[model samples]
Target: MTMSFSPQVLLSKVARERCIANIKELPKFALNDEGSKKTYASVLVPLCVVKEEVCLLYTLRSSNLKNHSGQVSFPGGKIDEGETEIDAVLRETHEEIGFNARDVEIWEKMPIIQGRNKEMIIHPIVGVLNNMNVDNLVRSVDEVEDIFTVPMKELCNIENHGHLKLQREKIILPVYTFGKYTIWGITGMITHLFLQCFLPESLYTNDFMRKKYTIGELMPSKI
Candidate 1:
């Protein structure tokens, strides 16, 4: 049977009653500041219609970079001094992939995500893109190595997802592979949380949420 995954349906189902207010305060672990001072960052989770299916856009980072080099991630970077989270994400998106603020419709701000090392706090802002073609993008050669999208249906496929056991902690973390790119760590956690918004409970059961991760429900856009 064919599945319906239209933008309108997704917007209605994920954004109708959910909002940032539903999320509780940041946990104690996320608030730890005993070590290196935490840095602030933001990312844009872009949803667009591609080839008649809803897909999420991602970028392959240049391998020469100092941090998170050669990994697939959303378009974002550190929030600049005196800049709001939304401003930083939009600016980073433009700088990284030539995706201008005018080309995206701001939707909701997901919960703040703290990096595993406790050195960074990332704010994920969800938005819908006006364009879907990768050829249309003018990526920053110094930052982005490539651009791609994975259909939402593929992400929801249980067969396409798996777990990687952490040797040090003996804990398992979710991992997802799309084409040649493997998404794990902070990106993987964000993806898992985002999928929970619209995916069925039966499809995302134990495997996806074996370890609890904090993320706010989808909120309506004021933009």
Candidate 2:
């Protein structure tokens, strides 16, 4: 029962249905804006699901690396000069994860994520690995320290994890405590957005509603 839907189709459907849902009163966004200010184009978050369940693929970046070192991230990098959003995402995925782009079935891209006036538009691309198993992946030693998969159900489940008010922000975010790593910041924001998009309306419960959805959901795309 592996569920598959065009990314565009799912995003459109979610927007139409949840357009009126009030923003969660969270202070995380304000903190993110104030703490670090950098504009980057296009981020690729890989959504891998198999056997009727969805899982998120993450990488622990090498600690010695510059920028977001030792943080949990998807297989993505900055958009190159003159590169399309899709090109950057696909290219970065190949370079970081060592996976052939041909094996990934990109379903839809989440709306363009805008920050405070930098013209660096971020896009969330959703794709499934042809076979959603660890056996199919090859993590790059240079960029990725380790590659791991967390079941989408665990992420969607409130009992599995909890949120925190970081930097005294009013908002609470889903912080997946994987070992000693806490997935936060933009990656956390993006993860929250996707859960809201894919979880069925009935299945969405308390914590689902408590967490503030990404502002990216409201941001308009150039297309």
Candidate 3:
């Protein structure tokens, strides 16, 4: 049977305090047990107020790019020598989305993540984009093909969430599908991490939650 999306689920709202408090005790990401030998990079997990709701910002890389062509990603790039995590994310955000450093309020530096598909240590920074107008932002023609946003409520909808399981490897990854974008790979993992802190248990649940519950009962998005 094709289960229907619940209309009674409460919408999840993004809270700065909630995010800060929730993630402190969480363990940092391991590099799939891979030893240190990867490039260092930084990406911004930008949250902005769109249409009176908190939305996540993302970019579709230009298909012409040398790496991860046409993939959906946050605004970021390799960290230059002597560059701190904040410096790299701010510079990349400005370059990719035309968001000024003054407009972004740095919130917290998330646990370190090393990409399995690529040899790179990614430092993900959570920042609040103030007075951001998606329409007014420019996408770099060279690196970014398109820029878009997804509301927190829409992302928390259980029907839109699933998993990617590797039978032989016994690996599981969270998946989120929003509109035409299918978030998987390392990007999918990052999105799941954000939702973990952004939404309450009543709204967002993932593989990490050991308790079993009906999907209908967990569908908390009003969208």
TM-score of each: 0.81, 0.68, 0.81
TM-score of candidate 1 relative to the true fold: 0.81
| Candidate 3, pairs of clashing residues | none
RMSD of candidate 2 to true structure, Å = 9.1
> Mind giving the per-residue lDDT tens digits that candidate 3 earns over 1-223?
0111121121223355777777675677755646547788999988887776667899888878888777778899999999999999999999998999899988888888878654778988888888999888988899998898987766776767777665655667776668877666677788888778766676675543332333343222322
Better of 1 and 3 by lDDT: 3
Which stretches of candidate 1 lie above 4 Å from their native place?
13-29, 34-36, 202-223
| Candidate rank order under lDDT | 3, 1, 2
lDDT by candidate, in order shown = 0.72, 0.61, 0.74
- What lDDT does model 2 reach? 0.61
lDDT of 2 by residue, 99-142 (tens): 77887776566765553343444677766666556776677787
- Candidate 1, position 176, lDDT: 72
